[model samples]
Target: MDLFTYYRSTSSYRVRIALALKGLDYQAIPVNLLRDGGEQLKPEYRAINPQGRVPSLRTEAGRVITQSPAIIEYLEERYPEVALLSSDLIVRASQRAVAALIGCDIHPLHNVAVLNRLRGMGHDETEVIAWIAHWISEGFNAVEQLIGDDGWCFGASPSVADVYLLPQLYAARRFNVELSACPRILRVEQLALAHLAFQQAHPDAQSDKPA
Candidate 1:
């Protein structure tokens, strides 16, 4: 398997964490998102993923899969040896809700494309940072309320929902979103940070980290 990724992308980070948790041995192919007018938009990379997105996965069968959520779901479904979703239907629904709150709502609003658009419209760095902070805080506060104080989003063991949340929290800190009020989320983040899978999947741990 091969994963085409960019270091700081939370989407890519989510997939990386999933792969690590699954104990999958895959090759990392870094595609710098910023250099040379964004390599993800380059013709070569687009051929692999016309969406020009990071974290595209190529399986052993040489089939390409895009979208972080889709890739994570594929891992959970295909490699169910170590379950990432709860056995109970209701618990699974709750976990999926948490994942959707972050993936569908928070992520799209603060993605690179949205920030770049703001900059293009003449928003300065401070303004751009403010925009990011506002959205993340609003979204995270709601999510934290939903999360409560548990090791994982649902109950105990790490689930697919957690694999999605931790990376988004990393982005929250990067954009200066105050998390002191989000004790539940902060607790989960700390727990996940201590785990090997999460540690190995950090942006700084990537081979593409800039010197």
Candidate 2:
């Protein structure tokens, strides 16, 4: 398997964490989202993924999968030995809800394309940072509540929610979102970051991370 990813992309980070948790071995192909007006938009990459997005997975069977959630789901479904989702049906749905809150509801509004578009439309850096902070805080408030007093989001072990949430927290810190009030969230982040899987999958651990 080949994972085409950018080190700083939260979406890419989620897939990396899942892969690490599953103990799957894959080649990490760097898609530098910053260099030369973004390598993800290049003709060669666009051919591999028409959407021109990072974290595209090319399986050994020559199948290409796009989108972080799709790839994670594929990994979960194909390799159930490590079980990122809960076996309990309702708990599983709740876990998916938390993942969606971060992956879908919040991350998109602050994605590079959205931020770049905001800049193009005359938003200043401070305003853009405010935009990011607003959504993260609002989103994390609910996340903090949902995550409640658990080592992971839904249990003693990290689940799909934890995989998605940890990356969002990384984004929150990068953009200076205030997390001091959310102790539960901070604890979860600390616990998840301390885990070997997450440690291995961190942005700094990536081969493409800039010094």
Candidate 3:
């Protein structure tokens, strides 16, 4: 398997965490999102992922998979030994709700493209930063209530919620969102940081991170 990834990309970070937790091995093909006028926009990369996004997975049989959620679902289905979701129907739905809350509601508002678009529309740095913080705080407020108070998001083991939450936390901190009110979320971050899977999949651990 080959993964086209950008080290700092939260979407790529989620996929890396999922792969590591599942104990899957794959070659990392760094796609420098900022180099040479954004490599992902280049023709070469568009051929790999027409959407020109990072975290495209090329499977062993040479099939390409795009989008982090879809790739993660594929991993969970294909490698069931270390399940990222619960077997209980209601619990699975709850876990997926948390993942979607972060993946869809929170993360995209502050995405590079969105931020760039805001800048294009004459929003200044302070305004863009405020925009990021607003959405993250709004979503995290709900997430703090939805998740459990103890280890991990749902229970003793990591779930799809954990995989999704950690990356969004990284983004939150990157944009300097105040997290004082989200103690439950911070506790989960503390536990995840100690886990080997999360450690290995961290942005700093990626080969393409800047010096």
Best by TM-score: 3
Error of 3 at 17 (Å): 0.3
- Per-residue lDDT of 47 in model 3: 98
Better of 1 and 2 by lDDT: 2
List pairs with backbone clashes in candidate 3: none
lDDT agreement with native, every candidate:
0.90, 0.93, 0.95
Q: How far is candidate 3 from the true structure (C-alpha RMSD, Å)?
A: 0.6
Alpha-carbon runs more than 4 Å astray in model 1: none
Candidate 3 at 162: error in angstroms? 0.4
Q: Per TM-score, what order, best first?
A: 3, 2, 1
Q: Estimate each model's TM-score.
A: 0.97, 0.98, 0.99
Candidate 3 residue-wise lDDT, 73-170, digit = tens: 99999999899999999989999999999999999898889999999999999999999999999999999999997888999999999999999999
For model 1, state the Cα shift of residue 113 in Å.
1.0
Alpha-carbon shift of residue 146 in model 1 (angstroms): 1.3
Clashing pairs in 2: none
lDDT of 2 by residue, 40-113 (tens): 99999999999999889999998999999999999999999889999899999999999999999999999999
Query: What would the TM-score be for candidate 1 when compared with the true structure?
Result: 0.97
RMSD in Å for model 1? 0.9
